[model samples]
Target: MINICFKQSSSKILGFNIEGHAEYGEEGEDIVCSAVSALSYTIVNGITEVLKISVEHIIKDGFLQLSLRDNNLEEIEKCQVLLETMLLGFKSMEIGYGDYIKVQVEEV
Candidate 1:
């Protein structure tokens, strides 16, 4: 039950939070965190040239927030696409693993 919340501020991408338990046990937890971290890294690396942004990973609450200073609508759109693509890839992997790991994406 990994929960992800995407927050939109003034139509320019604000940030997102990732939290919850993938399942019981340390291995499950680690896998969930690893997947999220990989996805976040991929997104940042993919759009680094297109948009200058800051990504914060809050360990205690399992939150990852990406904030963009530029308010360009095109940048926002690009970020959204990249983020979704990464998340979809994670979701596909989860399907094969079942409840061992999970990812939920929500727009806020």
Candidate 2:
């Protein structure tokens, strides 16, 4: 299952931790996983490449984690929209694949 967790600092969403994979089918043929991978990679690439924001991240087989390198709200504000939209996409995915994906919000 893919677990998407949004971290909150005070009332604002700081960043997120996305880990695991939704083993719904064979790796290459899983549409659910495809959608998620596309969206997740897009956001991560956008933030670090297009948006040129420094980020802390980790990646391994079946897992990926990402966070802003700096915690200052001002620094985060630079990519706030992208981060929130990423979570929104993840939540939408959960609506359809709740059995294989989990979405949660946590205070950090």
The Cα local distance difference test for each model comes to: 0.61, 0.81
Report the Cα lDDT for residue 60, model 2. Answer: 72
Best by lDDT: 2
Cα lDDT for residue 90, candidate 2: 83
TM-score of 1: 0.57
lDDT of 2 by residue, 7-107 (tens): 87766776777778788999899887888888978988988899787788877777778876365667688777887888888888889889888999998
lDDT tens digits by residue: candidate 1, 1-108: 666656555543455566665663586457656776677666766777556644443445555556554446666676777766766776686777656555554445
Model 2, C-alpha of 85: deviation from truth (Å) = 0.6
Clashes of 1: 0
Per-prediction backbone clash count: 0, 0
